[model samples]
Every structure is written in structure tokens, then in C-alpha cells.
Target: MTELARAAAADPAAATSPEPVPTTPDGVPRGQPVLDRLVALLDLERIEENIFRGVSPAESPVRVFGGQVAGQALVAAGRTVPEDRHVHSLHAYFIRPGDPRVPIVYEVDRIRDGRSFTTRRVVAIQHGKAIFSLSASFQLREHGLDHADAMPEVPDPESLPSFADRVSEYGARLGDMAKLPRPIDLRYVTEPAFLSRESGPRDARHQVWMRADGSLPDNDLLHVCVLAYASDMTLLDAVLVRHGVYWGLDRVIGASLDHAMWFHRPFRADEWVLYDCASPSASGGRGLATGRFFDRDGTLIATVVQEGLLRIAS
Candidate 1:
């Protein structure tokens, strides 16, 4: 078995039964859609005027996914601002790995409320300690000079194999790793970052087409926050792609140190978005990656930069 398969099989709680059908807001059980589950995960329950509590889904057993906290914190920050204002940018730091068993309390601080722009700071507390922090800026819609790098021409998303298909191709090597619930439908344009355990090209740059597994509502904030959650899914893979190392296969330990994103234009999280990612540098046991999100028509929607702690065991 491949190292990844062995690692997955080592976790007794890894492979659970399929998720039960979940009822929607309309009170109809339409099955457990990945997108709906993601939306529910981000939906914070108001605890106080400025404090909201978010829970990690039972599906994630250990540490809470950093993206979930970041997205939920952004949602908390957004809730305190005017509905007309839209998030323009966000910067966040992963203070500590969150304990999934506990609920995270998000405290939103109204940093500034300007006529044209507003800013909010949020702290995610767990076990009476700050585990994450974020600062986001919002602005009213306004016209501005616009230009962006053209999206590279690549195979359409429909032409690429789904992540499950690729994993299945490995047969028994991947074991039940293939059964892990995928919230995003990812279609890799090149060899996947995790497939480096076998023979493959070592390319620092990568591209993938991704979208929510199911349709989302028409809420703009929901879409943006969903993208925020998706953004963390693959960016660090660029670093592994560079060294030809897979996370579980190569004994590589990694976690996001900080994340930043700038919204460039409007986007729909449920639509096919091309994630163009590259690792510009890796040193001191850390790697930096940048990515651009583009719509099907090649319109740049957002740009993200992240630094991660990547250590390889000898």
C-alpha cells in the first residue's frame, strides 16, 4: 500500500458511513449536499451583539480546518457591516490549531466605519485562548480603473478527471482515502499534488477547476465566504509539487501560517473557477504560494497569497 493509504488506514475513525440526508431551510430533506453542509458549517449562531459561535462539523475529527475558521470569521465581520458594503480584502493569521471538539467563539471589533470603506477585526477564541485572528475591509460598490492578467488557456473543466476518478485509478494503493467527503468538486488540469508518490512531473505551478459540489443561494456574502474556504484547499500543494513530495506520502507536515486575499471582481462560488497557483519560494522550512481565481470567461475574480510551515521528516 502507498504511504497515504497506510496513514489513512491507521486512523480507526477515518472511514465513516456516508452522511445522512440533511433537511434544507425549507424543511425538506433533499439529501446532504456538500455545498449545503459547507454553508451550514459557516453559519454562525449569534451569541451576543458582537460575538458569534461557530462549530466544526463532526466530519472533521481533530483540528478544525483553518479555512473554516477564516471563512466563519469573515462572515462574522461581514454581519456587523452594512449590507451594501462588500468585502474587498482580508488578512488573517492561524494562531493555533483549533480543537474540533469545542465551539469557536468569534469576537468582532468594529475597527472603523468610514463613508466609503469600513474595517472590522475578528478574533476566534477556543478554550479561552485566541486561535485565529482576521482583519477585513469592506467598501461600497464603485467604478474604478480595471485591468488584469489574462487567464491562461487550459483544458475545460469538463475534460479533466475528477479527484475521485484519479484516486480510484490508483486502485488499492489509496485505500479508503478515496471515500473522504469532498466538499469541492476538483478537476485537476495536471498531475495532482498528492500523486507525486508515484512517477509524475515535478512542476511548481498547477491549475485546477473547482466549484461547490452543489448549487448555492444568491447571497453574495455566502459566495465570497465559500470561496474563502475553498481557497485553502489547494494553494499549498504548489509547494509540494515543487519538491515532488506528497503530504501523507512523504511525511511532510504543513500548516498555513497566514493568509491574505483581495477580491478583484464579482464571482459565483458555485460556478467553475480556475485556480492558477504557483510556489514562488520555499526556504527555512516554509513555503509561499500565490494564486489567482478566474471565472470561466477568464475574468480574474480574486488573488490570494499564503505562507505555510512545511517540514519534512527525515
Candidate 2:
């Protein structure tokens, strides 16, 4: 077993749970429980051909994690596409916060089906109001011109400890931040947690190695959903750290505003994918960051862009 695999095996949360059944008989484990719970709580039921209604849990807050809805919506859309065609890109906007106490309906519109591509449009609604919308594209694998920019060299995933270790060491100092859901194993390459105090202007780029905590099936759609879940982990934080604002700092209040991603090539989430990210600007209480994902062989597999609300506490 790999060191990461060992670390995951040692984790109580990961080790104790019964193996999760995939959404479909042949599907893979998508491993985002909060998302799974949201899907279950919403009691997603098919209302029309290729259309799904997602009801939210009464226990959740109205404004949902944009990533959760986006990932789930992608799954809903992927279910309609052919197995060979994998999602290549997705763009979405959070028009409003979804009320968790109520159900959010997801409607998938099949826009086009071509020899090599399929497009889908999704609208998420709450209380008879549109709350979020997304457009996603899928592509059939084919031989094509292939080249990728060089992967940024960073510390290997083996050199860093699991995030859980860091949190256990810090204990109560991390408070609620420590309890954030972490379905993927993450290890920082650029900024080790120990250097936060000795820093000057921080490096704009950040890289992490990640994969699902459990074995996943061979379906491509499950990998896409897992990518969507892991994508939200730390890209925007690169923007904040560029200015030296760690999460616990008194003045920082950051939340993701919008997220977009494009898959460039085929890759497995079970393997280490280096998330190379950088921040371009931060002004007017918002910051933007972009990232590229590269497999172990340096194949560029995806690109991600996100903007977040960064505010100073009064």
C-alpha cells in the first residue's frame, strides 16, 4: 500500500464505515457524504424524461455548498450521457443560496448529442424559485493531438503528513475549521503549515496531492464527481494566502462565490493528481484563482477557476 493509502487506512472515519455502495449497481463510490446526504434529503426523484427533482434536508442551511450542488448536478447530467463520453467542462453560477430546509429541484436539459460531444443544461430551484444553473459538456475519448505544459515540480505527496495529523496536533485551536468535511486525502506541496508564522510575501502557487479515501469503481462519471468534490478544497485559499491571510486570522471571511472546471484528458482520481494553482488578483472584496490538475506522468488532466467572497471582519 502507498503511504497515502496507509494514512487513509489509519484514519478512524475512513476505516470504520461500511463500504459505501455506488449510486448505480455498477457505479463507483463518489465519497462526498454531505453531498450524498443532500441528494438523499432532497429525495431526488425523476419527474420527467431525464429530469430530476432534488429536495434539500430540513436540517441544512438554505445556501448550499456550490460545489455539492454542482457535483450532484454533474452526476445527474452524466447519468444521461453515454458511458464512453466523459465530462470535459462545466460552468455554473450560484444565483442565490439554496434553503436546506426546503427541497431544491434540478432540471437537466439535454441540449445536443453529437458524434463526439454532448451538452446539458441544469437549473436548481427552491420554493418555486431558480437558485442555481449550470452548463456542462461531455466528450467521447478519441485519438487526438496531445501535449501539456510541464507540471510544476513540488514536494512529493510522500514527504508531507496527512491533514488529519496536523489537525490532531493543533487540537482545539482549529475549532470548527478542524471539523470541515475531508473526503479526499490532501498534502500541501508549497506551504507546509509550519511556515505560516515565518512568512513574508507568500508564493502565489499551491499544490496538493489528492485521491478518494476508498477504492472507486471503474466508471468515468464517478471520477468526474470526485474531481468536482476535491476541486473545492483549496484553490481559492491560494488567493488568500498570497496576501498572508490564513483561515483563522481575525480579519478574513472567505466563501466560494462561483466555480468552473474543464477536463482536459483522461485520468484516475485514485492516483495522485497535482493541483497547481495560482491567484491573479484580490480587490473589491473578491479574489480569483485558477488551477491545473496533472497526473503522475505530468499529463494535464483538468483546469479549474474559482472566485470567492473575501471580507474583513469588523
Best by TM-score: 1
Q: Each prediction's Cα RMSD? A: 9.4, 7.6
lDDT of 1 by residue, 1-314 (tens): 42222322454232222467543332323322655567767778888989999898776746888889999999899889988999999999999999999899999999999999999999999999999999999999999798999999899999898776776655355443344466788899878877764666486897899997766666678789989999998999888888888765678888999999999899988899999999999999999999999999999999999999999888
User: What's the CA error at residue 204 for candidate 1, in Å?
Assistant: 0.9
Candidate 1 RMSD to the correct structure: 9.4
Q: Please write out the lDDT profile of model 2 over residues 122-197, one tens digit for every residue.
A: 8887878887788999988778787779997777888887666655655356565555554576777777433453
Off by over 4 Å in 1: 1-32, 170-177
Q: Which numbered prediction scores highest in lDDT against the true structure?
A: 1
lDDT (Cα atoms) of all candidates against the true structure: 0.83, 0.70
Where is model 2 more than 4 Å wrong at Cα?
Answer: 1-16, 19-45, 54-63, 169-171, 192-200
**TM-score between candidate 2 and the true structure:** 0.80
Clashes of each: 0, 7
Q: Give each model a TM-score.
A: 0.88, 0.80
